[model samples]
Target: MPVKIRAATQHMAMFSVDADAAQAMIDYSGLRVCRYRPNRAVAVLMLMRYIDGDLGEYLEYGTNIMVNPPGSNESGMRALQSAGAFIHHLPVDQAFTLEAGRSIWGYPKVMADFTVTDGHHFGFDVTIDGQFAVGIDFRPGLPVPSRFTSKPQVHPTYSHLDGVTRETAGEMTLSGVRYRLGGATVRLGQHAYAAELASLGFPKRAMISSSADNVEMTFGDAKEIA
Candidate 1:
């Protein structure tokens, strides 16, 4: 049996960090300094172009980050505390608009525009819009590293036309099976698949379940899910 994919979408946004202002905020708050780009290994510009959606949603990356209170010693536990505060202050009123299109590689593409009030401000408002496409592929599955815990997974195996893109590719993993972008192979785990989706900005509260013959993903709101 093959796994079935229901819906896929994209989001994009543009943002700027006032490094000087952020530094001042850190100083005033007595918090440890943090960089706008927390994940130094990944290319911010490349991700911006690839993600291709609202600016507010994709602009900020990484987990909880915060400025330590002024005069407080920079200790690991204190830093974690500040991080928790940062999470508590996240902005929730962001909006996005998406326009559908196709990528150069014939993958589905969505054009998006995004904006944030102030990156330096805790819980700044943001807006975004973007497009995404999902389809079937015939790529081979890759092996999962042994250090991880969980059974291996595989890609959905089926052939049908849903008026989606005929040609599309991106990495996908399910049930411990890893699937290559544009390829139809899967070799990873279910948990890994769910984690990847969440990391990519999928709604965390959404339900992901599987039957013997199919995989199911359900979101609360249609607008948010698409």
Candidate 2:
């Protein structure tokens, strides 16, 4: 199969977690977490609006634990550097993408109701299985050099299955990008899955940012983690 491409606008944030707690999430993912210290790891919360893709328009909510590439000690850099995300939870607004994501990449995606509103800032509300899961409010910050203008990025990600795990690699490009660091408000509700995210310290906002416009991504095939 060929790489699946999507045009999107995304809101992302990074935060510090109790390294032990973050490690627990990584361990649960069946992939090892690279420690910044003896007990510290990083968590990323992403909300995406897919304007065009194989499945057309949809919304995706990803809660991820950023880890090192399998056995590599690349932790000397930043967490997002690896892009080897251990997806803690991924919720989307459509079944087509849900089926495609799972069948193509082994992504643990499910259907949900999503309201992603973007303007002066970006915000989203997501509900899964008829329960409120998460809500986030983000403010745009400043412009940094565009990565989409530079070389494309190939990110390797890991997902767990029955007694085994898989690896999915993706390449991404973006344009007309303006980066900013600002404030975020995250609400973790009473849903069971929502609680699972809370366990990873979702409420604490360490870093928040937004892209003003022009972003695209191509997600490639998923392979076995060897």
Candidate 3:
């Protein structure tokens, strides 16, 4: 109850990775990777700056792969629509959020430094212990399909770490959402889990989108993933 559910600005670049590679990553955690096709998986790289929240203000860089638990239907539509994202790497600039997120949702959050700027584009760089981990430069101002926000994008995520697995449902609403097939630069470093990006052929320039305004969001308490 200490964490505040508030507004935040989010920037993201989505990529299609080799389904086998992504499935390997998910397999390590005992989860199943959700595939858009038989051989491709969706990966989302995000940079978020909270304008106002229970933890005040902070920036976070997240690398997530869409996935579902073993029993979940693996059919593209059912799998992709579950909102069962698996967090592979997460770094936050604030300790308050780091602890709160991990305690509440089993989010794999670690303390780090983040630099963000925007003008003609949305940009961010995340550093942990003076080493670059990930960065993104994205262009906004694109057309969004009416169906993109036609319904609430609410879904549950399952996080498994340190021998524990937790599930939390989050309903996210992004204002001024814009969609585009390309127009973003992504960078992944060699340190830590950042190196894993290479296996997915990350920064390959795929689907990109952005929201100039705030992200309306809420997270439910964690429950053991079934």
Candidate 2 structure quality by residue, lDDT tens digits, 7-64: 7776777776776777776575557676665566777788878887777788888888
The residue ranges of model 3 lying beyond 4 angstroms of the native Cα positions read: 1-4, 143-151
TM-score of each prediction? 0.19, 0.89, 0.90
Q: 42-76 in candidate 1: lDDT tens per residue?
A: 10110111122212233221112233333443534
lDDT of 3 by residue, 57-128 (tens): 888888889886557657575667764778878899888888878877788898888777778777888888
lDDT ranking from best candidate downward: 3, 2, 1
lDDT for each of the candidates?
0.24, 0.73, 0.76
Model 2 stretches with alpha carbons more than 4 Å out: 78-80, 145-149
Scored against the true structure, residue 112 in model 2 reaches a CA lDDT of: 90
Weakest ten-residue segment in model 2 by summed lDDT:
74-83
| Model 1 CA deviation exceeding 4 Å by range | 1-22, 25-65, 68-72, 76-226
Q: Which window of ten consecutive residues has the lowest lDDT sum in model 1?
A: 40-49
